[model samples]
Target: MLKPNTLALTVVLALLTALGPLSTDMYLPALPAIAQDLTASAAQTQLTLSLFLFGFAAGQFFYGPISDRVGRKPVLLFGLALFTLASLGCTLAPNIESLIAARFLQALGASGPIVIGRAIVRDLYEGARAGKELSRMASIMGVVPAIAPVLGGLIAPWGGWRMNFVAALLFGAGLATVVALRLPESLARKSAQTLSFLSILRSFRSLLGHRGYRVYVMLSLLAYGGLFAFISGSSFVLQTVYGLGPMAFALSFSFVVVGYIGGTFLAQRLVGPHGLDGTIRIGVACLALGGSLMVVLVASGVASFLAVVGPMALYCMGVGLTMPQAMASALMPFPDRAGTASSLLGICQMSFAAILGIVLGQNLDGSALPLPLTIAATGLMALAVFGLTGRARRG
Candidate 1:
């Protein structure tokens, strides 16, 4: 059943998943120093990360749909080329504004694999295999992001923060070369007149009509929003307010990610027996518990910056637990529109987080408490939406 190709495909998909993390993590350790050098506020520097995510979210819409029409490899190469060039721009950027603008373009290019690769996997496998494959790829990201900040912290001072972008540029080029040489064209030759925008508009309507799809997308958007906000502000909370150095922070930061890894591993086992509904319930419950702890810490005036260590990990675990089920359900009905479907999901996810990130970044207040409280509030909001979506479907 498990062929070598299946394993190879998993590895490739893992590399694709690596793109987002590679973009985010490598620069994390340098945020504080960059802020000082750029003479910008913590919030302003954070905007650079948030803005890149904004581009990452928006880019998915164009690339995903186009890949459906033209096939995966060519579209992938095109995005990678743009990403590589953008990375060069980032490296050579003369100021904070220039770096931020180039980061947006770089994220636009990097988003190619993240948005399209999910659909490509669907093109190759379906049903339970699809969910399993997705989890396998997510596992790589879970592990990689956990360690990336640590690595970034270690290298950033020695190499300069900009070197991180150069590393990302090189990594993208290397991955593109591997894909160019090794990847087969996976899209089946479909000669059907590619659905027009108006027709795809109807497909969107039909997609919303499906109860499972609506629930899944909304849940993923809410869930991922919380994580993005945390990432957006962790530098300020940990390194600046709490006076942590890069290495200490990365090591402490990863402890939270451990919760996510545990939850996803558990979800993989539980999904088969408990079903999507049950797995999501457990994930949300854990998330709610984590969120409540955050609010409690802040309200009680007992908040140490370290209070984040426990809750953030739990929150990320909930995301890992819920992602496979939500992803599987969203993709289940649209084998034909896998690209379109994934693009839609990507749109909701990034848009949701972008709004939340903008709000959180705007409120940094020179204290660590706001960061955790913002994360807690977003987590609470996500749990509420997750519950409502589930109830709406049942009624």
Candidate 2:
């Protein structure tokens, strides 16, 4: 059993970690409204999301190294403050281009909490214990995606799409207050690393050169690539291909959330007994199975909604199972460079996902083939990379 304060701290960390997903998911239902209201084309409106991801990936490179030199608390506070201000900018933007720019800044600010939160977990724990804590955090944060779209849909009728930004602003403000008042400085000893280009380059090079870190980060990155592929293609596959209504599609999407929650629960229970590598292997197997099943089903001319969503739910579960362990393993070898490690890990995940999203968006062909094929390909790549690199190191 955990203490009350410990539980509260976990919840706070989870919320801090959840800011990115909440920002993205909560605003999804309003995309059409945003485009229509701002007189923007679909591609231009979509740039808001793409730019946000770009900013998110870029911001982590800076935040990680800076947090290592400074402290987690200050960086987190600065991020939350920036996120709040940027959310306000998003809410007040008079045109689509301005909204796109504001969204980019908002994602840049949001990246701080995410990268720092993972580093904070490393500060408190290590190895499988860190994996367990991260699994717990993932379990809690899983609820954000489940609720965000519904909340956005409900609010959009009353106040239009801009209200979504207002909600995000309030969330950022409240979280900032809680963090400012309660969160402790987890980095007990700060790194002597400076904020120079050469220093950052050296730090990144060091992390990238570590074979174990590279393997684990690649595993996580490929897993997220599959997930982002699903996210990018699901709406089209479900609504456009399978003819599901918006409400039905939303409900169907919840299955992935449920599957993720289940996977995290399983990870929390299993990580201690099986260890990080064992847990990750199980996750990879599940991911491969899910992706493979999707490909087979789609290729066999199964056009049912379950054919698409069922395998996706399984893929999401694999993501939940894989992420905590892989993240823990990736950062385990670099205690001194936890912030930098976390940031690089984040950059790879977001960058790959963003690229996958762009590719999937551009290749929509009115069939279920593209989405499932992408998922399967990514899963296979992740498994192959892990087996080759991870096994060689173990041997």
For candidate 1, what is the lDDT?
0.78
Per-residue lDDT for 333 in model 2? Answer: 85
Clashing pairs in 1: 256-313, 260-317
Over the stretch 11-68, how does candidate 1's per-residue lDDT look in tens digits? 7777786788788876887888888888887767887888888898878867767777
Report, for every candidate in turn, its global Cα lDDT versus the true structure.
Answer: 0.78, 0.86
Off by over 4 Å in 2: 1-5, 392-395
lDDT (0-100) at residue 64 of candidate 1? 69
Best by TM-score: 2
Clashes of each: 2, 0
Error of 2 at 326 (Å): 0.3
Question: Residue-wise lDDT of candidate 2 within 291-347, one digit each (tens)?
Answer: 999999999999689998898888889889998899999999888989999999999
The stretch of ten residues in a row with the least summed lDDT in candidate 2 is: 1-10
